[model samples]
Target: MNQFESLSRRAIQAPESGIVAVVNHGRLKAGLIPLWAGEGDEKTPDFIARPAAEALLAGETFYTWQRGIPELRQALADYHGRLFGRQLPLDAFCVTGSGMQAIKIAIEAVVNPGDEVIQITPAWPNFAAALGMSGGISVAAPLDYVEGSWSLDPDRLAAAITPKTRAIFFNSPSNPTGWTATPEDLTAVLELARKHGLWIIADEIYTRFFYAGGRAPSFMDIMDEDDRIIFVNTFSKNWSMTGWRVGWIVAPPSIIQVLENSVQYQTSGVPQFMQKGALAALEYGDAYLETQITKASAARDLFCDALTGTNRVVTQKPDGAFYAFFRIDGISDTKAAAIDIVDRVGVGLAPGTAFDKGGETFFRACFLRRLDHIEDAAGRLADYISSL
Candidate 1:
């Protein structure tokens, strides 16, 4: 057999990222207002970056605790206390290389080969892809899409759980769709998990980006001490530290060591200097994060309004995250349209095909950018939609 055919089926079957394909096509294009990626246009603030630089320069690069440094874990606890109004033990926190890694470790800790994970669709494709790589099947429990709003249906979610299902992967304030779960929704899902004795892998990375007065409703707001829930969060969105690759998990104290063991095998813990910076973000970056939320809120309104004004796009200002996921009136092939939008209008958008099922005809734009850029990109997109 050929070398390509000799590789494992799982490795060979992994799909190419549809978003990255569009990005690769237009990355070097001139004057492109790129919003295809799930990150803001801002750099990591000096307050957060400086500490890491200083720590690196001071030779803090040694291999450290797999469960994260004690100070950083304590800071994570304090940060959670401030946000969730709960005091969790330090053992409940295990730092991973990224939010993506946290999800993988959570999957590994619970799922065995041939098991299933029921995920809400249209999801950030990485979770399903990562789950597949770990020999887990991802069954879709698609959200109901009506009048440009996305919402969960608890009965549908429960129906997706089969005997082979080990967990439900939930991402609220979702990446591509900005579908934030309500308090009632949280309670419903939690009850289902309780009934099914299934684990809940909570991806609440965008909780702070909620535009509804305070943070988005979280599982922490409702879960009991012994609930079968694991929260995976990242420092990327809050502090514009996308490049830092730092994320943490909050699981039952019973599973912290097990998750840390996965960390030991995968990355052997995050860099010590980077943990120092993450510690700084947790301890001193609240004001900075608030400013970012404010900026995203403004950009969301401007961008969504502009697209809506076209009268040819179906979208609403998303309730939480920084994305504006919309469908153009005449565009059924979002992948082709994404390329055309990038090549013709110099605006980068992620096609919905990247976001898995139930998102095939939509497009996702990251609106956490400068107001002027948002305005410019919105105008260009509106014009393109009008032409379509």
Candidate 2:
């Protein structure tokens, strides 16, 4: 067999990230207002970065606790208490390298080879990609998209479960769609998991980015103590620490050790200095987070209005999250359209083809940026759509 064919089937069959492909094409272009990635255009605030740099310089660079440092975990507990109004035990938190790692760990913990995980779509592509790498299958339960709004249908989700299904990977205030689940939606999905004896991997990293006054509704608001839910979150969004690669998991205490063991085997643990920074973020970054939310709220309005003004884009201001996912009236092949838009307009956008099913005809633009930049990108994109 050839060298490529000799690799494991899982490794050989893994799909390239469609988002990254477009990014690679446009990354070098001058004056590109890139909005393809799911991050804000801010650096880690001094309050958070200074401590980590000090810690690293002061020799805090050793291997650390597999779960996390006690202070950081406790801080996570406190943060949850404030955000979710429920005080969770420190044992429930397991630190991972990033939110992506947390999802992989969750998949490894609950899914065996050939097991299926039902994910809501059009969803972030990473969960399915990670599941496939772990030898599990990803089954899609696409959301209901009507007009410019997206929502869940309980019966549709319940229909996706099968005898081999082991878990449900749910991302609210979703990456591309910006579809925030309502309390009623959360309750129905929780009830469905209760009936099916399936685990839930909740990705609520965008909860704080909600534009509707307060944070988005979460599974924590309604789950019982014994419910099988695992929360995967990151410091990337709220604190502008995407490059830090620090995230944490909140699972039942009984499974924290199991998840930590997975950590033990993969990456050992997040770097100690980084954990110190994360602690600072949980401790002193609330106001900074609020500022990011405010920026996102305004950008959401401005960008959505600009797109809708073109009358060739189908979108509304998303209920939450920092992205505006819309379909241009004449663009059918989004992957090619993304490349053309970036080349012609100098505005980088993620093609809906990167997102899973039900998203193939759309484009996603991250709007968490300076107002002027958003205005510029929006104006350029509006002109592009007008020309179309």
lDDT of 1 by residue, 102-183 (tens): 9999999999999999999998999999999999999999999998999999999988889999999999999889999999
Colliding residue pairs in candidate 2? none
Task: Write the residue-wise lDDT of candidate 2 on 129-190 in tens digits.
Answer: 88999999999999999999998998999999899999999999898899999999999999
Q: Per-residue lDDT for 32 in model 2?
A: 99
- The whole-model lDDT of each prediction reads 0.93, 0.94
Please give the range of 10 consecutive residues that has the lowest summed lDDT in model 2: 206-215
Worst 10 residues of 1 by lDDT: 379-388
Residue ranges of candidate 2 with Cα displaced over 4 Å? none
